[model samples]
Target: RFMCDYDEAGSIGKRYRRQDEIGTPYCVTFDFDSAEDGCVTVRDRDSMQQERVPMDQLADYIAARIQF
Candidate 1:
């Protein structure tokens, strides 16, 4: 659902900012226990609110947030 071009020095925070500037929406990080947790930190680029939501419920969550 997304794509990126990497810069060697790019930090995760900086990368998120770049995606925000480009009008992209969500980001998912795959850590060791991401699947087990069944939730991930989702950031609202416009509001910068990082919310932890269940992975199995991600589609529903994002669908609820979709603007008009």
Candidate 2:
């Protein structure tokens, strides 16, 4: 099981950049709005592509990318 420990001192954008520097393949942000909408933006590190997908199905979406 994986858990996210938020860096309270860092902004979300900075967190994303840090993850990129560490070669993280993708980033998933859970915002207040996400719970209601069931969607969040997915950021691709290498290509810098961003897409919006459902939070309900995010795990499978991310797992698919990790296999590549």
Candidate 3:
């Protein structure tokens, strides 16, 4: 199983920064549009690249890249 954390106490930037400081491999963000689009923003900590991934496929998408 994968460990997940829910954090919404600060701004998105702050949240990203916090995760970056801890060397998180990826960060998934569900914003207002996610409810309608069923997509979440997946950010790569190393590349600082962001992509939209459908909620249903999120797990597989991350699993494909994660090396745990």
Candidate 4:
């Protein structure tokens, strides 16, 4: 099973750092733009890379890379 955490207590960068500290492999950010584009920013903890992914395809996208 996978776990999901919702945090909105700080700046985006701070939030990312918090998750990174806990070894979260990925962090998805849904901002104002997401309301229009239906996309979210997916950040990779190790690589520190960010990518915009469509909401509809998000499940399969994360499923493909997540390891149990």
Candidate 5:
């Protein structure tokens, strides 16, 4: 699940779908602000809801939401 430096050859939306079809629970994207601001965009699979969370606290944040 470590894709911080992942910049594949496709639109981000396309990448999201690829993850979705494969049953990825969430997709965390790192951008310019990620390193500087210490935040990431976390997108949920079932609801497609997204949120910004501090990178330092990401693990705890996701863990809280995972049902199992």
Candidate 6:
């Protein structure tokens, strides 16, 4: 599953921790950089690693990386 998290402070680490404690698989963060470039930050629940994803290829990237 995928969802957008627009919490206060734009703290990806904090959000990841909260979601991790609750067992969320993934969280997508849309920041100011996205407005500048068509991309977003995707955090891996288990690894806590983030990577930039172009908006145009986001769907494909997720489909290829996440298996449900």
Q: List clashing residue pairs in candidate 1.
A: 38-55
Query: Which is the better candidate, 1 or 2, if ranked by TM-score?
Result: 2
Each prediction's RMSD over C-alphas, in Å, is 3.5, 2.4, 0.8, 0.9, 2.9, 2.5
What is the C-alpha lDDT profile of model 5 across 17-55, one tens digit per residue? 988898888888887788898899999989999999998
TM-score (all chains, Cα) for each model:
0.71, 0.74, 0.94, 0.94, 0.82, 0.74
Could you give me the TM-score of model 2 versus the true structure? 0.74
Off by over 4 Å in 2: 1-8
How far residue 54's Cα lies from its native spot in candidate 1, in Å, is: 0.8
Tens digits of per-residue lDDT, candidate 1, 21-56, equal: 887677655445677887777778778888888888
Please give the RMSD of candidate 4 to the true structure: 0.9
Give one digit per residue, the lDDT tens place, for model 4 in 1-68: 45899999989999999999999999999999999999999999999999999999898889999977
The better-scoring model by lDDT among 1 and 5 is 5
Instruction: Assess candidate 1 and give its lDDT.
Output: 0.71
User: Would you list the C-alpha lDDT of every candidate in the order shown?
Assistant: 0.71, 0.77, 0.93, 0.94, 0.84, 0.78
Pairs in steric clash, model 5: none
Error of 1 at 9 (Å): 8.1
What's the best-to-worst order under lDDT?
4, 3, 5, 6, 2, 1
Runs in model 5 deviating more than 4 A are 1-7
Any idea what lDDT model 4 has? Answer: 0.94
Clashing residue pairs in all predictions, respectively, total 1, 0, 0, 0, 0, 0
TM-score of model 3 vs. true structure = 0.94
Could you tell which candidate, 4 or 5, scores higher by TM-score?
4
- Global lDDT of model 3: 0.93
